[model samples]
Target: MSVVSDTIDWFSDSTHWSGDDGVPHRLVQHLGYTSLTIAIAAAVAIPIGLWIGHTGRLRGLAVVSSGALRALPTLGVLTYASLYTGIGIKAAIFTLVLLAIPPLLAGAYAGLESVDRQTIDAARSIGMTEWQILTKVEVPLALPLIVGGFRSSTLQVVATATVAAYIPGPGGLGRYLIDGLALRDYPQVVAGSVVVIVLALVLDGIFVLLQRLALRNRPAPVRSTV
Candidate 1:
């Protein structure tokens, strides 16, 4: 209870984002990195995942590729990007994107694969263009899995984005934790850790709400076998 009360107190002023006379916060920098991670992951993962799932033949490829990518050490990507890009948020984003891609791609592929084949046949019989069948029938049916992937990516990014703080150029809570640890300021380290956890849970809640609303609006997908 004291931690919650104190956390609220610390955030009462948004201007606390600037490292200043106060505790020297850098939350905004972390949020920026999280956003960059999500955006890049979404861009790369969603479409490729959808395509592979829809094809069915490529599900193997999608699974294998995503699994391999997921297995790759995030530190490797982070180190590569950080060294080549010369530090800062951009390099961090590159690392986060890699972290985010696997789940997103797998989810999208899974969702699409779950789609009813009969509906697709019906769509094709009714003179729907291949693109139309894909966009309307396949994508809509796959929404749950796609959103699931998105949720996974969101969570992954939330945690991994903290690594950016290590790359320099004004990091988020990681920076705070590091600084606090360096100075032996236990309270500040605890505060920054609490902030990161809260941020991740909040982001997860928003995505869950979105997932429910989206499913609620969509008509139930026609059941079919692959």
Candidate 2:
């Protein structure tokens, strides 16, 4: 097909692989956006989720808020934020962080909650402090789920970071989509999409390995004779 051949030609072009507009540079920019978004979202959401799970307070609030956030249209939010913030990476990151929070928040609380209540009781019964029980028993058991949340958040951010190119600043594989559409160069668009897909897959594979690693060392469940 012409499309396939054109895409191949596009990739074979050395110009696309070098300079500021190159694939490697765009990928690094995309990664910077994703890393910053995840870091900020985790810092904000994980603590709140942990508190809700640990104290049994505010679970209702977390549910409602996370659901509301998940329902937001990401591009619409980015557009509004860009308008408010003057069109730059700040607006893009704010939108991406908001997009990433629900999963991270859900994962944190759900992970903590998934820990056997009996195990927590056992830890408490042994004269362990609340902090120690959370740190030693609950957190270790909950890590897999928490990491699952991070995995989900990371993928979502990587996909959405492409949209960041729409605002005239920030560069990522999305530039291929935006620029390709403008120039009607379908081959570049397809190439960009392929690269984004590959990046996401690679990141996901890494997380899968991390999940297995977390599971391997997870603490054994505690049984209580209530």
Candidate 3:
């Protein structure tokens, strides 16, 4: 109860709202990190995934690489990058982009693979070029899953962007955790955690809405009439 009260008090403190280190500033910093990470990861992963799926080549490589990437610890990667490249926002973004890639890659390839092969053949039969088949047929159909990838990647990036605080650079809500722990201010830590959780949930809800919107416009499966 005391901890809860302290957390509430921390929120009630107006001073926490206006400075460079305030919640709003930190939130923007976090968003910037997440946005950049996601953009880079998507750019790197999506095209490779698309090509692999379209060509039916390197499927094994994609699978192995995604698993390997997923298994790597973000902090370990950050530490290594910081040591080799020097601690800064670049190292932090690089770590997060790595973290974001696996899912986006998986999402792209898996979404493409989910398309019925016969559909592609039919498009081919209709004289649609390979690019047209992909852009018009495969991509639109795969949007829900692709958005799902973005959804997963965004959540992961948001949660992990806090690690930037440890890199001696801009931080998100994680600053609260790091600063609070160092000062033995558990309430601030709790408050920071609460904010991150809320941010994650809000982002998740937006993705869910996007998924629904995607599904609503998706073409329905054809059925044969007896």
Please give the CA lDDT of all the candidate structures.
0.74, 0.89, 0.86
lDDT of 3 by residue, 1-226 (tens): 8999999999999988988878898889888889989999999999998898788899999999889999999999988888877856888989999999998998888888888899999999999999999899998887788888899999999988876677777577889988888899898999989999999999999998998887885566422100
Candidate 2: give the clashing pairs.
none
Structural RMSD, model 1: 4.0
TM-score of each: 0.83, 0.95, 0.95
What are the per-model C-alpha RMSD values against the true structure? 4.0, 3.8, 4.1
Q: Give a tens-digit lDDT track for model 1, residues 111-202.
A: 87777788888999999998898898888777766777788787878777666566676477677677767787665667778788988899
* lDDT (Cα, 0-100) at 151 in candidate 2: 92
lDDT of 3: 0.86
lDDT of 2 by residue, 77-126 (tens): 98999998996688889999999999999888888888989999999999
- Alpha carbon deviation, residue 5, candidate 1 (Å): 10
lDDT of 2 at 124: 97
- The true-structure Cα RMSD of candidate 2 reads 3.8
Model 3 is weakest, by summed lDDT over 10 consecutive residues, at 217-226
TM-score between model 2 and native: 0.95
Candidate 1 residue runs with Cα over 4 Å from true position: 1-25, 218-226
